[model samples]
Target: MKILSIVGFGGQGKTTLAKAVYGHLKPRFECQAFVPVGQNPDIKKVFGDILIALDEQTYTRPKLLGLDENQLMGKLNEFVKEKRCLIVIDDIWDKKTWKLVRCALQESNCGSRLVITTRIYEVAAYADEAYKIQPLSHDNSEKLLYARIDDGEGKYFDSLSAETCERILKKCGGVPLAIKGAFLAEELPEEVGLLTQLVCLRAGHWDYSWIDELPEEVGLLTQLVCLRADDYAIRVPAGFIGKLTSLQELRISCRGKDAIIMQFVEELGLLKELRVLKITRICRSESIESALLESLGHLHNIQELQIGNYSLSKYRVSEAGSLSYCRHLRLLHLDRLVFSALPAWINSSLAPNLSYLDVQVVVVKDQDMETLAKLPELSCLILHLTGTKLVSVKLLAEGVGYFRKLRFLKILGSLIRFDVRGSECNSSRVPSNNTIMPGLESLEFGVHVRSLKDEKLQLGFDKMLGFQNLGTSSLQRVKAEVNCGGASTWDVEEAEAALEHAAAVHPKHPTLLTNRVESQYMISRYQEV
Candidate 1:
């Protein structure tokens, strides 16, 4: 038998950590119970709850209602003395409560375990072993913030600017609860307006739950430099954003009526000092589209811009000639928005400082590729093909030199065929050594398999020798999502084998991850190798 206690201040994740440990070890015990004893817990009620949790089938609420604290203790001692059990008593406030609870659980030779969580150090020291929990570190704080804000998808978090992330983390001060509450809270307290000197504020729910209203008091924070609210249902009063003229970075989303969203877009034109702007969940309309384009033209100082409607549908903004006005742009992410082709203004002369680009287009023409390759500082590129027909694109040895500084490249499309120049030989043989993306560290692409006999679509384990042609020395991670919708059992096996073989042959031996997608329209579940 053993007792372990965890001590920590409020909001340091003591309960969260205890719950995780309990979940992992509960299956090994004969019986398990988790009971929370708050500041003024009723002794009889706490004991009764534990008895019910340990034997739900036998301990009915009606049957236990008649028992007093002494009777409940008698039942608990008799039950636990014979059975090996795991119990967690969370949020104990005082030593008196602990003594009563401890007396009820009889010591046994059945190899039982007891865990407790408390904010009181002396109470925790009463256990056989005490663990003092500490606040999260800087790296873990960032991970937790991103994980909560993105809801595990990680698409939005990756595109965030370093300056914005740092400001939010500093505000959270390494507390796990503060980090999570900063983004997940449903509504701010009315007193939030009192913090008139606050320079940064980030608040919203990840699940897109409808908030009744954003406190109009938020407009009082005129000194805020960074403000982010991701809730889609927030209806900003007409002049709410205009009040925060000092804001350098702003992110907001709305999925409500069209009139509300149109007004929100028009308000952006007032922020002359804005450096980063991200707006999503927009309901596209002719009037709103015109207003959105006009607003983009006004933000001359903007350095990063992200706009999209997410999964609602592919938003069409091909006529956005106003994008040419923001010459200082270094990062551009157009999520799920489909254009006929690359925007005419996306060239070296217009966006000379461009480094990171993510876009979805119907077809990537030769001229479009040429324009993208000319980006002097380009480092990360994510391209998604949305055409109905198969689009064949080639990466020639000579053209590979253009992406000398590129480090991360991801191409996503089931109907696109990527043919590397020197990798056209037989599946079993290695390709001629032709290094591509010499500085690349991460590579991700999609593969579509319709049949085993079709040579054009055969990217099975044997046909994946194209990886050898990449910058193997700098490569660190490779991910492939194979769609096996119509392929037979043998074809799936061959594809998996090919991925494993490719990973093994690499001289640097980068970590390999394969996502075997069973259908084209379904979500992918990844399997790491």
Candidate 2:
């Protein structure tokens, strides 16, 4: 047994270092498990997680889920009896839980290795060798502080003096986590009200199991241009973020549904200067849903927005037209939401400035394609269509220089066909004054296939190649994802070979890749572009 322990102070990076070592050694072992035991660890859940992580192939998922703690330990013991395993148990706060876990791995004499990370010295004494984590040096601290001091427009750090940098480092005391939390607060005077001028702020890593709410003082930073409170649960006070009149970028993840959070979303429209906003963990709420649809119409200056509902169940985009006034909007990503067809606002008159759009839908229509083609500035587009049958859709049809600036396009879903045989889309014709996606550089197709002799897939590849040649031929990469729906895997192999050969003949000789989902065949070819 190769046993190692990582011991450190509360904020001295014990778990971080343990994860690094686990990632490096995982591939060398026959089976691997990494489990986090928080301050108040749940022993039963921890053992269950270990069994699943170790790849217990002898039992079905349903059977494993139903196993008791003793049965789970038996399954884990059986799995590692004949195979070498690597295990990491992170952030153990007490000895009782460790003893419980030790009972499961005690007699598996298969040359297994274990790594434990803890804040207590007693836990470290249980291992063969203990590694101590240290604080960062002054030079390293300076580099980290300087890299994170950027204002929204990059003016804040450029004006920071050497004396100010030294003062901030001394206050951090060489601890990494402390350095992150205590940034800029010491050098800037409170009487001068520097927080009002601050733009970007990233809170320290939070463990939500203990911490539940944010400081009310956060609402006073009225001039904040960007804010990121990732993976932290916060109870929002009414009009908290709306006070930041100049705020342009905000990224936050909420834990559950609350009326306070809904009010915050409703008031977001008051900050007309916002250009980028991303919000996650949207649960079911009628008030929250109404506020979202009603408030988005007021963001006239919005540019990039990403909204994700929990899943495809109850979420609906009923008022997509609310974004019609977002003339500067680009790079929109909506996940696990349902829309009947393309929204009407995706037209030249409404959202001409759009450069990238990613959305999921159940069906698409011809007018949707026409409207999308008219987006003169569109460069990248991803549509993940899911439904009964995502059969046919026309792309870049005959037009007056539609998709002229398109550079990348990805379409993923069940089996679909591309009809490019129309005379208007004749790829053999000489490059006329008008062209489709002339700047196109990469194309990806993901389709569900019944067999390798999938004629629709083969024909789609042929047409896609022709589509690539019609462009600048500055094409640098092509990828195809084939999801198998039948027993035979030979067809996917042949398809991959054909794609590789096609890529070989291109003038630029771009990189080509074919990934077979049901089987384990992946072909990647890289050539000089």
Every candidate's CA RMSD: 20.8, 21.4
The runs of at least 3 residues in candidate 1 whose Cα sits more than 4 Å from the true structure, single-residue gaps closed, are 1-198, 203-211, 215-223, 284-290, 308-311, 387-390, 394-400, 414-435, 451-465, 494-501, 504-507, 519-529
* Clashing residue pairs found in predicted model 1: 461-498
Decoy 2 TM-score against native: 0.56
Q: lDDT tens digits, residues 55-159, model 1?
A: 999998899999988999999998889999999999999999999888888566799999999999989998899999998999999888777546345555555
lDDT of each: 0.74, 0.67
Highest lDDT model number: 1
Clashes of each: 1, 1
Leading candidate by TM-score:
2
TM-score for all predictions?
0.55, 0.56
State the displacement of the C-alpha of residue 132, model 2, in Å, after optimal TM-score superposition: 34
